[model samples]
Target chain A: EDKVVQSPLSLVVHEGDTVTLNCSYEVTNFRSLLWYKQEKKAPTFLFMLTSSGIEKKSGRLSSILDKKELFSILNITATQTGDSAVYLCAVRGGTSYDKVIFGPGTSLSVIP
Target chain B: SAVISQKPSRDICQRGTSLTIQCQVDSQVTMMFWYRQQPGQSLTLIATANQGSEATYESGFVIDKFPISRPNLTFSTLTVSNMSPEDSSIYLCSVEPRVGDTQYFGPGTRLTVL
Candidate 1:
């Protein structure tokens, strides 16, 4: 079965703290890894990593994938209360249909 | 990224009833996916809807329980038949405009079964 696991199911940090969320997956025919930020309703797209050793960054949020290790990490530098949300990691794979499997998610609480 | 919208943002229905959710995309998409997220749980894909064909359901999900229709490349619908309290969840519609593109999500339909 395709599985995506995340570490530290929940985390609490004050403003300006840097946090790192981890995502590891085991699937057949790995293609791409994606990260999303879910606030209240729907999840918003953050980054998609398809290659190893290369990092994708956006302002305070950055992410990188390590295909060799079968994992990815999302880093948030100088976080704020607005960053409090559920961070979700998903992997798309499968040679026949390309199914996307999602992790349980990391609930972040950035206190002001 | 594509813009997607769902009808009846939320609904509260009685048990044994059924609700059909609509998803509309601004641009033509080849594939549309339906997902169910239970309270505080991860997203579970219900099925993949492709135009001109029947939807392919995921494991544990059947067509009788969750029937889907993709009339065209830009619109689709999912009907949750015979709802129960356990069926209460947030149903989201997503689409990837093109291959290798990020899948964008709709606001989602919040359904609560009594």
Candidate 2:
């Protein structure tokens, strides 16, 4: 079975603290890894990492994938209360067609 | 980037009822997907709806339980049949505009079964 696991199911941090969320997946075919932020309703796209070693960043958020280890990490710097949300990791892979599997997600609460 | 919208943003229904959720994308997309997210659980792909073809459902999800319709590239609908308390969840619709592209999600419909 294709599975994606996330660490620290829930986390609470004070404002300005830096946080790192982990996602590891085991699938038959590895295509790409994606990170999303779910606030209340749907998840918003954050980053998609397909290559190893290289990092994708946007303002205070960044992410990287390690194909050799079958894992990925999302880093948030100088986090604020607005950063509180459920961070989700998804992997897309399959031999015939695109198949996406999602992790349980890491819920982070940034308190001011 | 694509803007997706889902309607009946939230709804409450009694057991044994059915509800159809609509997903509309601003631009033409190649593939649309339906997913279910139970409270405190991860998202599960229900099926993949492509225009001009029957939807392909994932294992454990059958077409009878969740019927999908894709009449065009930008529109799709998912109808949940025989609702129960256990069926209460957030139904999300996502689209992959192109192959190898990041999927974008609609706002989602929150269904509460009483």
Candidate 3:
């Protein structure tokens, strides 16, 4: 069975803190990994990583995937109170590699 | 990125009632997906709707409980039948503009069963 696992299920950090969220997966075939942030009812897209070592960055958020290790990491620097939300990591992999399996997520609470 | 929208942003319904959520995309998409997220939980695939074929449901989901319809490339609907308190969740619709592309999500419909 394909599964995605995330570490430190929940985190509470002060303002301007840097947090690293981890995601590991076990699947039949490795494809792409994605990150999303959910504040309310909707989950906003964050980043999609398909290569190893190379990082994708957007403002204060960055992510990288390690296919050999079958894991990915999302880093958030200088996090503000507005950044308080659940960070989700998902992978698209399986026999056909079409379905996206999501991790339990890391809930970050940023205190100002 | 494709713009997606869902109707009935939030609703509180009685147990045993049913709700139909609609999803609309700005552009044509080959595959649309439906997901359910329980409170404090991650998103779970409910089904996948294609324009010209019947929706394919994921494991632990049945068509009778969650019927989906994809009338065109840009629109789809998911109906949740016989609601219960356990059925309370946020229903999200997502679309992949092309095959093997990133999936974009809708704002989601929050349902509460009382």
Worst 10 residues of 1 chain A by lDDT: A92-101
lDDT minimum window of 10 residues, candidate 2 chain A: A92-101
lDDT of 2 at B7: 99
Residue A107 error, candidate 3, Å? 0.5
Assess candidate 3 and give its lDDT.
0.92
When candidate 2 is compared with the true two-chain complex, its DockQ is: 0.93
**Model 2 stretches with alpha carbons more than 4 Å out:** none
Error of 2 at B105 (Å): 0.2
TM-score of chain A, all candidates: 0.97, 0.97, 0.96
How many backbone clashes does every candidate have?
0, 0, 0
Instruction: Work out the TM-score per prediction.
Output: 0.98, 0.98, 0.98
How high is the TM-score of chain B in model 1?
Answer: 0.98
Per-residue lDDT tens digits of candidate 2, residues B1-114?
899999989999999999999999999999899999999998999999979888999889998889999999999999999998999999999999887889999999999999
lDDT of 1 by residue, B1-114 (tens): 888999989999999999999999999997799999999999999999989899999889999999999999999999999999999999999998886578899999999999
lDDT of 2 at A56: 97
Task: Give the poorly placed runs of model 1, Cα more than 4 Å off.
Answer: none
DockQ for the candidates, in order: 0.86, 0.93, 0.85
lDDT digits (tens) for residues A2-52 of candidate 3: 899999899999999999999999978777898999898788899989899
